[model samples]
Target chain A: MSTPIFANFHPDFYVERLWDKCIKCKRCIRECTYGVHIWDEKKKTLKEDHTKCVGCHRCSAMCPTNALIIRRHPSDFREHALWTPWFIKNIYKQADQGGVLLTSTGCALPYKNYFDHLVIDACQVTNPPIDPLREPMELRTFIGPKPEAVEVEEVNGRFRLKKKLPPVIRIEVPIMFAGMSYGAISLHVHQGLARAARDLGTLYNTGEGGLHASLYEYGANTIVQCASGRFGLHIDYLNAGVAIEIKIGQGAKPGIGGHLPGEKVTEEISKTRMIPVGSDALSPAPHHDIYSIEDLRGLIFALKEATEYKKLVFVKIAAVHNVAAIASGIVRAGADAVVIDGLKGGTGASPTMFRDNIGIPIELAISAVDKRLREEGIRHRTSIIASGGIRCSADVVKAIALGADAVYIGTAALIACGCTMCQRCHTGKCPWGIATNNPELMKRLPPEVAYEKIYNLVKGWAHEIKEMLGAMGINSIESLKGNRDKLRAVGLTREEMEILEVKHAGE
Target chain B: MPLELEVTPFHYSQVNKIIREHISKGEREFVLRGVNGHRYLFAGVSAEVSAVIYGTPGLDLGAFMRGPVIRVFGSVQDGAGNTMDHGKIIVHGMAGDVIGYAMRGGKIHIFGDVGYRVGIHMKAYMDKVPVIIIGGKAGDFLGEYMAGGIIILLGMNTIYPERPIAGLFLGTGMHGGAIYIRGKVRENQLGLGLKPYALDSDDEKLLESYLKEYCDDFGLDISEILKEDFIKIIPYTHRPYGKLYAY
Candidate 1:
């Protein structure tokens, strides 16, 4: 309602109804939640307001007669190199209403993505590649600390493990769904993620939100988070998850706290997050207790103590500068795993500046952290989970090759669940029902449907990852870890290639 | 009969393992002797059990504990009841910082002084209110970012008469809940945007209900603790930082 005329004049998307192919049905009006479509009785035709559309393409996909065309508005303006449309329009928005420029999902910037420049190597005639169809190619990954040494003893002519191993989260695929709180998305998405994780033998993080009562049944596949807000955290919620993750910061908005606006804090969200109905869930910027690495150690052990040391405990931080050193300290602080989220990490809502410009890319961070830990003789002590901007199966394979134990996908997971990345999540009126809490919009994404989509997505990606592994002549995913020799960079600077730990294409 | 477990010789893990083992075996009452800095004394004991600790216990003494009544005879360390869902923790002596950090339900009654940031981010829901009643003086940054619950600081009969009842930055960044100081509090001692108000009937009732149990926990007279008029400190807005940023 507070949208200024300057923003309204330039539509972000152009929604057109093909008159010749139009069936004159009212399906567009019903499908759109942004009030973009209206049926005129006099002309027996439909009209649309392109400015109201967020480019979700829901109507285009659902159009019965395929009469809808949605694209970026072709409106032209004299281009200024520095002040682009978004910059100029954002200035207008702030001048009129003075609210933080907010957005959802990953950063939309065109920063140098190392994944695009780096290519995975394939086996030539000299090395025979294993066919995934015939040979057993292991993709199984265990996320936790490994013992310093394994002591085996002979038992009735059979070798047996002599000591009890630490707890671990076992996953068949190296890809996982990143943390998206129940309040940020709909309950349907959380249920879907949980069911998918259960069905895929993987894990889905619950973000900082406490576990919903209905989701406790899928505890074996869930990773409950403890953040600064400490919301909805109790013994039951901690025990309900397979692992506990201390959410120090997120990739999208590093160093800042999360604010689930009061409007989106519905009754069920209030119940799940353990706050009063209609109250904003403000997670504090810092865990007040964790002021130093020792303090972090205290909380890490505290969680371990709470769970009686049965569940693995992980620490997640954004891929900021000096991330490698930060990760080293975290490992020394006794975390079983470290989750590094890059600048391209997605969020339900984040200040645009922080989302785009705050953190480094996951590619560099994972390489740096893995190399540092290995140099420090502690790489085997913990696992590194890289995330942010993981697009397809190739990206997943590259991340693992760069020394990540696995990767977490937030935006990619949502895209599979029908998100078009329209950047309207902060408005809390998501037309695709992927980022809204409204009951009607949430109904569009049933739990079963979301589960099916995400399940197929991961399943398909897993097969593709196997194909990549087969081409690389690697029999197991673990054998590919930290194997930067299998990667080559094209058109990257020497310094960038050094940071990425990949060689030039010819070399 | 309470089972006696001397936890001085074994590691915290072994001590805690034996303690939880008895708990799962339906042992409701426990007596931990010589508990010299043994951490996680009753961690994750969800059943309705009770423990009597003799010596000083280490960090997170009862973290994530549910429905357990704990009575510590000696002073306790930081994170005494960290994130405990239900039950009571009664410390006969004093407590360290973050004694009840982020605890959602149950009550913590410390008989003596407490360290800084004692009740940081403590929360409450519906009828399940988390309460922390400190008998002596408190340190700085008390109740910082506390969302919901009640923190009653009774600065009566403190050892350090030279110091104020509470240090600087009291109730800093508090968005919910009320802090009842059993005496006058200067505005300078409170955090920015926090105001002190006179107690209303509901505040009086809430204080009375918790103080009755508090007085019994420490064997103190309820009338003596309530003799002084109390002032309350609360955030004016639930969202203190709501209007901070531009869209």
Candidate 2:
């Protein structure tokens, strides 16, 4: 017999079946999309193959009785500090297949998560904290370019604005749905996101994939993206949303591109992307026409002109080194908003190497960009949206205090929609149905059911944001913007604090 | 009747504002003279309007415009027909880079040579098949990453005879589209796994129809332009990167 791979022989997860509690119902067999469970016909019982388990826990959750426990395999190779098990296993897999390692979602490496090391400040004796229930707090945020100065004129014994400003988008909450492409995820999830955004008075992004014809009614709450591929880009799609975003780079895989495989291009996806059925949809590493900052301005104006200057235009870039300079350039290029996605962003599919090791954290990026733009006196020209790795409402408050105008939450939204982050989304076998396009899996997540869940999550977060604001003795969210005095680093180094533009605790 | 103007004194933005204001006022015809380096002219004008421009126009001449016909007598800068939905832009002189980038529905007929990266990622939907017929040579990366639409490169009647009919990386990463070269292309000039083939009847019909329009616009003989043996290039497989990943 051929030698089995070590990872398969000693799997990452071990499924323990409590034979004492099992009733021979074989529910696990029906729920296992990875085909890990089976019915032993001779024994008339249920069995499992540990090697096939991705640790999604769908069967365990749906099991009638508490009969299963999925745990990490307590096995290890010879200990080596530098050469870890993951590197060894990945090298073995690459040697066997001789192809690029593909992965789903964000970086799983144990890099420093700055959000965990920072703390928010609260009111003390000098200022009393207000009660959120008894008092009204303003969480209303506007996203667009602000003029250099406000000018007023007297008309009919009434003072009115002298000049008209550009279009602005108002959101009741400071949180938004990150750009999730339609082909990478199911349509039900998109419908849920769109409806929830409408319900919450916020916006949801349509990532590069063209908007579906049925979702035209929700254009007022949508921000359609123009990716490098220019997929489904027409005059109608350009004007189909409240604003337009030009996707320059994604955080999970910076400097790389995106490709939706031909096999996954169903008829519906083909029509939305405006490509032929079964054709590979490729977004190259760069827009061939965009080679400089001026070129970036060209495309921004193209979308603005395409939409007849009625909608705000945003530019999304990965948070890499010198991000502050890049943000300033984008602001000067006529961008109304700059979305900086950090390295911890999620994706449906990306090369493993790029996903794990590219771009800086969003915290440092927000501080750097905000400081640079303010120094350049162009901070009012654009709004800064910090994305990637934002977890709870606390993270949103901290991000705003660190200098972001708002935050985009992707994984948090997915978790609310029943995603367990199995890390197997690219395999097209997502049991919870959040990432797959297969009809059988797609039916598992109904849009009507998922929209309510998303709505609850955002509404709950908005309330929590108000509470946090009240604790800080501030009743409005705008007061929290760039107010680093409310934040103090707990365990970060001096250099790190300097980069984040925050003071150390007990200083 | 055309609303005539001398657009030399105003900036490109001001000229565009004037054009937009006129377009919204039901003025469907315009004749602008001395339009030196004026960019974004007639942009996003979806009306069935027409413009006759004299002197050189800057970048993105008719970008995102629909239902408007523009005739330019001088050479244009970069990004002439950028993402244009529906219109006709007839350039009587040479053009710059990225002329037909992402154009969905329109006909761009350039009477002279074009710069690099022309027709990149130009796609089509239903009856909105975009067509670009180049009367002279093309620079590098022509038709690179094209998903759909038709590009015809006629490398003749140009000042740069030393240049190749089309440059390197022609149709690189192309899928779901056809590129027709007037004569022939070496195997090295083609994208990976893409091959040139003899024209079928349907291809000949497409060429005849599109070339007649080109010939009529330039006042050239259709027979002379079609005298050479043309070749068509289409990808061998729509899924070029299917086997590139392990999972």
Candidate 3:
């Protein structure tokens, strides 16, 4: 085989073998698909090729004696905080390939997690905490435009409610699966998410890859996306979902379009995406017809017309600097809801520079949008869904308190299904089979197994959210939404606290 | 054929309700008059019905419609026949932008001009063909990102014969589908990934059949329209950005 013009710059992981414990079992050699471990026939011992290791830890987990250890390669650069080892290595990578370096998953840079700094208030005096075990804590959330006021009438000595409201989707929990296409992940993963969404009474997004025929049975729990590519978009696809989301942008790569390489467009993917086999699926940066807010309104109404106004329509945008203004325009454009994808959002593949350096974090975006809509007296016009890096139930609670109706979890969902976050999803060779399309690798993940794990993960988070709400002296999740008085920010500037509409700690 | 509904004061929802109620009662043929800009008329109605609309219909007139024939006597608004699987929409007057947006299977015959991005992202599946025939000129970005289906532009009354029939960047990012223009097209007006070709016998046959229906709908002479020389624009390669990546 011919060598590449550019060599592998440096080892990303170090494989440490316990010499006394290894029994030459060769399990690591068999488990690693990247060829990181090889059995040396001449010496009758295992050898490590550290250069190929993606730090997925597949071999280490498979080792019977726990003889294999994987660690991040030690920083070898001179101690300079500004020009760190990661910075220098990325420079080398760009210099070698002269191409945009692609990475997967969320941002790995050290940014403050606002959720950790914000503390939820618990009742001590004046009010008492309700035990969730014995009390009924309503976690059900209705996502759509709420009515402005209730209208009642008395007809023939009988009082009746007479308010017509927009269509709303009710979910048992306020947590939902974010948009991730089938070609980006495996069919089994999509099935797992679909099953989990059905069991949890939530919705899972199809993420612009068109709905598969087999998954049509879960239409009540599906949110089909109509992206710029218009892939696999037909009348049936539009009518097969509970809601339709117009994907304007994603947080990881805000201003650019998505390029699914022709190589990844296998036969099944081609059918799902409605493109020719081996043809690249290029979603343009902007919808060709939607140039202004009026254009967006036209498309929104068009979709509503297509589905006969039976399904809620959502407009999803990245959390950019002007997210508040953009969100307001989306509401005015007749969307039933708006989703803001923050900078820490995960992706199947994105340029490393764009993923790490584009868009604002979800915390600030949600707060600003919420404040803007409230100031305009249009907060009840539509629902807001905050998505990015919501790690735990606390993050979801914090988001709701900051004015979000719900939260979408992408990377966390993948991690629940055995993903190690190796950030090699773009390679199409994921070892755990969650992000790859290779038939052999995809076979490793069974839909039933993934379904159970994800179901338990969301179920646990829902219980925790209920516990937090009960401790706050709130019986329903709605009472906690937009109730910023229940939260206090620590280590945040006065301006930051003002923007978040929360008080500083000990105020 | 005896049912008649006046949609003047009723909201779009009420209009649709009345139409659906009539449809559910096995009334396939109806006359809808006094339609004053009501949107979503006959949307997602998958029945073999014929609706004759008199006044101007609003946006998305026959969206997601299947197996129905909607004949509008007046003009229509934007997004007409949006994402329709199988249907026939005949518009007598001018239509707005994004006409036939992402329509997979059906036929749309427009008698007058249309706005920008007409037939954007239209595609076809196995044995399902979608066709759009425009009698007059079209705006910019015509057939943009067109994956499959066929679009024909017949410049019957050319305001400027010196200029090209369609606007700039025609067929931008078009991978599949064929565009037939019945006038002169300059090389500079064409977008990337496209190459102009002469009409083959099969192309002539397809154009003849579709134009025969179009002529029948609009009361035009098919022989006079076919007398003009036509040029066919198709994508040079199915994969436009196949070599844009390193790996």
Candidate 4:
């Protein structure tokens, strides 16, 4: 027999019963982006290379015959009890050492005690919930520029600028779609977001991934991203949006390069991006030119110059331990807004290890950053947008109450558009066809339908947010931001409570 | 008449103003020589023309191009082919960074090494196949989430002692077409999501035709170029990203 290349092999592991159910249809092999399965016609059997599996579950999900039953590799630790303990011990060592976990994409860490760690409070007897039907609740708030400081300037018996700032450029709601590039998802997804944001009177982000020509009509409601890649970036691209966001880092792949592999680089995507086909589109891990706060200002000014300062410039950073320091720097950099993505933010694809590890939680990260900025007295200078695991309205309320001007929705947006949280987005075989770049699959999702869903989701969230605010006796979102006095820590230690800057209820 | 716009002191003003007017007037062919790190050289040129840039051109060269042929005699900087469509782009020297971001169509040839994410989200249309060829080493994610078209990485002679010098995450989420990496690469070193095999005779012939055309363009000896073995990465099926999710 030929030597088995793979280290671990078991003959008994292969179920003979599965062969009887095999219909000879190659759907699993065909659908699997990783090419893990091969049909051996001569043997009347399907050969699966377990090593090649990225655990996307696309194969089992796509199987028409129900022949393929993919389960977690069955553990035999009890049979080989001696080696199992060492094996388990080594994994802890790896975790303690802070070494690379070598995962594929998105967070795969075992869900920690999130509910216990974070807590929200509501005034029970004193604050009566305002009726959302009769009473007017304000979720409306501008995301762009504010006055440099709380000062009124008089120029020759008149204000310096003739145009009065349109009372916080009122949006009907607080929820907005987070930055997911056109390349990472599909044009249909972009159109869906654009249409949805427009309908909802909110905004959708065209991530550092370039904007397709088709979605140009929804520019008024769009937040065009200008990341290190600079794809689809031009005077027109800059000017053709409500806001321009400079993407510094992503929560999923923090401190890593923004890489869109060549295979996903299709003609339409390439045209939108203005890059060549089948060439890796690399966004540098670090903005090499931006060495200091002064350098960041130079970039900000350059963008301002290019766009004639009409568009709002936002500096986006992954919420790290040092986010407070970074946010302060961004404020000094003269940015109108700051967007912070927490560790749980989603990606089309990222190293599994990086996604699970390497960043601070949104709850912890936000409170710390908010406190840091406020302490530095720069909190009001720039607007704050927080992302990562804002799955529902409660999270959004908690986030805004914790000092965020607004919240950016990522995983939730996907969920609204029929994303099944399969976590197989890195492989371009998203069955709902939302995340992959595959032309055939992307066509499955009509832009119109997808857009409507996003619109509905955001609208639903907005209504819920208004309700939450009414219950808290607050009418406006702005009044709720950084109002952590309304919230309290549940199971946190004294130090943790201090760090979160919240007291226990009834304290 | 072939016009020469020589870049001096890293200032692209003299050349840019003229090219802007020339492109506005719909001039087809222009040559820019001695471009030594001049930034934003030919950005947002929406003409169906060709400009051959000699020497290194700095950041965002040929950004948002619409049916324009841009050939770099030497290297170019960040955002080389950012959102370009319907033209040919050739880089003789190594490209600095972020070669083709979300490009739709057109052919880009890199004679030397290329920086990361060569074709991030490169899509294709019916008959409008976008082709990219890299002569030297490529950075990570060679063709990330590519919906269609062809991406060829010819790992030519490298100064680095590493035998198989290719990028990480090669052909990740590649649904359609092929990625040809020259030379045998170790499994771990290649760092691709997909495992590819050696090219068949028919595919080798197709690659040879392109290689021949590349040789003619850059004046390379065809025999010498074909000396190295080529590995062809084909998705097991045309629809690698088969319907895997549902509402």
Best by TM-score: 1
* Candidate 1, A187-278: lDDT as tens digits: 89999999999999999999887777889999999999888888878888888888999999999999988778766778887776666666
Question: Scored by Cα lDDT, where does model 3 land?
Answer: 0.86
Candidate 2 stretches greater than 4 Å from native: A1-10, A16-31, A38-50, A64-68, A155-157, B2-6, B9-30
Off by over 4 Å in 3: A1-4, A14-52, A63-68, A74-98, A154-158, A164-166, B159-162, B199-209, B219-229
- Tens digit of lDDT per residue, candidate 3, span A1-507? 964533364777889999899998898887888999988999888898887899998888879999999998773657897997777767766666666777888877768778888999999988999889999999999999988887999999999888666679999999999999888888889999999999999999999888788899999999999888777777788888899999999988898777666656788887777667777777878886588998899789778866778889999999999999999999999999999999999998787878899999899999999999999988898999999999999999999999999999999999999889898887777788888677888888988988998999999999999999999999999999999999999999888888889999999
lDDT of 4 by residue, A333-357 (tens): 9888888888888887665567888
Across all candidates, what is each one's fraction of true contacts kept?
A: 0.50, 0.59, 0.41, 0.04
Query: Could you tell me every candidate's TM-score relative to the true structure?
Result: 0.95, 0.94, 0.91, 0.64
| lDDT minimum window of 10 residues, candidate 2 chain A | A3-12
Ranking by lDDT: 1, 2, 3, 4
Residue A445 lDDT, candidate 2, scale 0-100? 92
Candidate 4 residues B23-75, lDDT tens each?
66767688887888765555555567778877888765665565778778777
| RMSD of every prediction | 2.4, 2.5, 3.1, 9.8
* Top candidate, metric DockQ: 2
| Best-to-worst ranking by DockQ | 2, 1, 3, 4
Instruction: State which candidate, 1 or 2, has the greater lDDT.
Output: 1
Question: Residue-wise lDDT of candidate 3 within B1-247, one digit each (tens)?
Answer: 4589887889887888788888899998978889889888888787888889998888788877887888999889888888777889998888888888878788999887888889987886666778999888888889887878999999775444555578988998887788999977888788885768999999999889999999999888999998888999988888875544332
**Clash-forming residue pairs, model 2:** none
**Residue A472 alpha-carbon offset, candidate 2, angstroms:** 1.1
What's model 2's lDDT at B110? 93
